[model samples]
Target: MVRANRRLLRARYGRYEGGPDPLAAPVDLTEALDAIGEDVMAGSSPERAMREFLRRGGSDRAGLDDLARRVAERRRDLTRKHNLDGTLQQVKELLEKAVLAERKQLARDTEMDDGDRMLAEMQLDALPASPAAAVSELGAYDWKSSEARADFEKIKDLLGREMLDQRFAGMKDALENATDEDRAAITEMMTDLNALLDAHTRGEDTPEQFDEFMRKHGDYFPDNPTTIDELLDSLARRAAAAQRMRNSMSQEQRDELDALAQQAFGSPELMQSLSQLDGTLRALRPGENWGGSEQMDGEQGLGLGDGTGVFQDIAELDALSDQLSQSYEGSRMDDLDLDALSRQLGDEAAVDARTLQQLEKALRDSGTLKRGSDGQLKLTPKAMRQLGKALLRDVASRMSGRQGNRDLRQAGAAGERSGATREWAFGDTEAWDVTRTITNALTRTAGEGGDTTAGIRIEIGDVEVQETEARTQACVALLVDTSFSMAMDGRWVPMKRTALALHSLITSRFRGDDLQLIAFGRHAEVMDIEQLTGLDAQYDKGTNLHHALLLANRHFRKHPNAQPVLLVVTDGEPTSHLEASGDVFFSYPPHPVTVAVAVRELDNSMRLGAQTTFFRLGEDPGLARFIDSMAKRVGGTVVAPELDDLGAAVVSSYLSSRRSGGSGGAGEDFDGMFGRGWGRWG
Candidate 1:
């Protein structure tokens, strides 16, 4: 039986090195735009609103605040969980083992002279209690046991590796059990490095010199720096972190390490070289935070080099925290350092920040936002249409759910085209009767018998437009309460959203309808869709329904030939009314005069034969009673929808009123609406 041997396959997993993770989900621009629109409608500037959305992030992506919080946590963990005494502890252990081995060897040697053995024991016992002193005193002592002598020499090797590692990262592991030749090579490299730094400081160093230096000692630096500035940046950051670690150490620890550091490689040469390098780095890169310190009070011990690395990490975290705050002048999403963030917090964080950057850029470049003539960021007309559509969709969804899947968008009559054509006049938007127009042009050209080579000269008189039988149109007045109570009770945004939804519907679908947005805060004013959507929350304490009703009546009077429809949305009774002198009279409790004035206006609207609807918000007993009474008096419908359903309720009521005939109008068939301010845009 021939059996084949099986081979095992393995896979390695590391950090993804591509520009961005393909697996990372893209930012939802719609969700972001909706959030920004809400804030914009709530009185925030477009730029401020966009910034807030990015800072808050979305349901699936981490935001700036979350990343900043994580950075703080990571920094706290670094400082709270470590102390800098690894090398000192290691040196003390080696010293103890060496002394014990020497004592055991002395006791085992039977042929040694009594006086010589006593002398050796006295010298060992007489050594200072300090690890550094003990190691230094043992330098001249002769040892009989190879094990004891090796342990004694190991202390020197440990100090040498640590000292080198402190100056140049990775030296500790790379120079394990280093030979004299290796030490000589390090010393040579340090000399050359110091010479290069001195020349650079004097402004005499050339790029060639920098290239030569790297070529000679490039392996010492793991970060492959191509320019002198890059090299300095790398070295300065590490060197500054090392200084901070020293500053953080207690005075006693500093003294112990100082003594121990001098004995590195059984000499003081390495420490001297390192001290010179630190000085040069600090001098050349004075912007480094060389005086900073941290308190490390935990159980885990870190050597000098590792402590420096942690300090560097803390510095990077600080930078990320600042970048995420975005509170500084000229601060922007692109200011965030993704590379440093990834190194400190992981690739996921970098991806999140990058996504936010892309989102902000897209919003700005998508023509959704623009800078006004005043140099302030504002939403563009396109943004208004987009926001309106989103709100309309939301309203439709709620209406569908509430009304059992009924179509929310009721189609308005666009009228049938009359089988006759007339000459097109300026400002006429009616579709051109193409066949009639061509026939007119052909007849005119034939009658004139003009040049036959060139294209037929069709004058303005030859253009004939097709006329349509006028459809009955409705004049809608959406009176929304913008009083302080609305803002306090969280009805401000909902009311604005309702207005925008209805406006969008009338302007986009029912182009023949005239919709007026009247907001009654301390006073009533006629607002366009853009004005109402971006209206700031009012703190004035008055719901001027009387003034709003007056405006509605005037709007109905203006469109005398169209059907009148009045919709009033309010959360309170009439607390204020407009006096004959045009002054506002406001009171907390329902003023009798104010209620009388509002009632009189409602009666006037009823006489005008407007189809009316009262959308009462909140559960205040007085408000419900007042709204029911008003609706009953005018024979109008009353709807009490939740705040979330306000938009749907208003939009549905508008559509319902259009379907039902008004109390009075010119006729069922509208006339002269084709070229007479039909669409909102016109």
Candidate 2:
């Protein structure tokens, strides 16, 4: 009898004799955030920024036009200076060449020896005689050479500048005197001339064709530019300006400018080149002419002018008048009531205003607090509940489960049994025996049968069948690491997500299951799922895995039949603890005392028939090895999943364990989920 009693006791309690080891696997969280951060940032609304930009008179189009105008003015200035510089250099080179020619002529005139003449030729050649090089080296040229170059250069510059001045004068006079129609036509012609000249220098059109084309369409260029060389140089300068214009504005800015022009002029493309030219002329430096006045004698000047000269003069004046009119229009814009324009735009104003408001609302709604308000935006109960539901959804998406499969399966040890039968319900299995149903019906009706006829009375209540469902009670304590390291490394968010998901699953799907949440850092504390949402790490502290496990063991002691498990997610190994002196003891690699404390906790967990599973998030191999050693001692499991795969790996392990009847252990589940067999210890 004594031997039999000992055998029975061994069968009942032997599995609790040895404790399970603690396992640690590090989780990586940064990789997951990278995938979704960009999408979130871009979709964030831009309406507010746009509205602010417009309120500052930085409406895209206006800003662009302002930029374009500034760029054009600057380019014109630079081009003029550049042309002046080039002309001076060219003149210097021309002087050098002339001086050399004169030296040769003088040598020949004096009947100098052939040797002297040859020497003079060689000297000139050696002194950077190329026109291009001479100009570039203008500073080094002799004073006489420089002066001679300046003289020739001044003549060309004066001729060009004077022509520009005369053109402007003629345009101004014609605009003041010509008929409105003639003024308009002349403005159009001037615009065409500016565009043609601009296009020609940009290499968009051949110089000869452009000049001929301008003369044919408008009388402005009838003289064919007396010096083709000077004309080519001028064209080069204009081309530089045109290139500057192309580089000055971005596409978006240009589009906005175009829109602004359209609003002001009815047609954004209605610009008259002549009017623009007139504006350019008025903005030019003083003493410039447009008719080459200084270069021609009276007869030559008169001959230079065909019947077209008068027409050209009239056209130029008309363009200048139009330019002045446009300038006046621009000036008047400031006085015109913006309120009136606002009304004309109508719903656009309201939309813009509302968009601005929405932007402010969004900023306020963000988690940050306002200056004067309380530094808290309490989550409404509805949002809290939604958060819980979201967690469950996330977990469910990560876990694989049989959907709508209601077949009852036995899971845990059988308890006291009693049989009960009930009639078939809508969701009941169709496998109920017909014979049994009929027998039950007939038996029930036999006693009351005197009035029952044989027409076949089959009632819904007569259907009966026997079914059984196994009750698998599980007590799981989730030990979340709330260390400062976890928060700093961005492990906290996903950890919370996983915790919430697990809590939701237990509360909603397995309502009868025993669940506990414990947070451990420098110390261990029990917390509820509701409180977990606001869980934050505080102080530089150590993780007390031992304390958490010990507490979990104490909680699970009351559940004699329930299987117990401990899940710990941490980034660092245990580091600090309270000492007998009522002071905290700490270490970098975790002191021997910390390890002893943790080992004792594991021993206690084993003594209570509970398994501990660890999920680590740090990169320390030492921690992993320590976790493996603990798992060996306690017979639990260690999983080190990449941060991106943490959610899936966690859910997969749980599901696999559930399917394997819980006896296959956490190590088996880890292997099933990740395809790598986890090494098991004693």
What TM-score fits each model?
0.84, 0.39
lDDT of 1 by residue, 468-505 (tens): 54356889999999999899999988998888889888
Worst 10 residues of 1 by lDDT: 673-682
Q: For model 2, state the Cα shift of residue 164 in Å.
A: 41
What's the lDDT for all of these models?
Answer: 0.83, 0.49
Model 2 C-alpha lDDT versus the unseen true structure: 0.49
List candidate 1 segments past 4 Å from native.
1-26, 402-404, 410-471, 588-591, 663-682
Clashing pairs in 1: none
Candidate 2 lDDT over 381-405, as tens digits, reads 3434455565455454433233332
Q: Pick the candidate with the highest lDDT.
A: 1
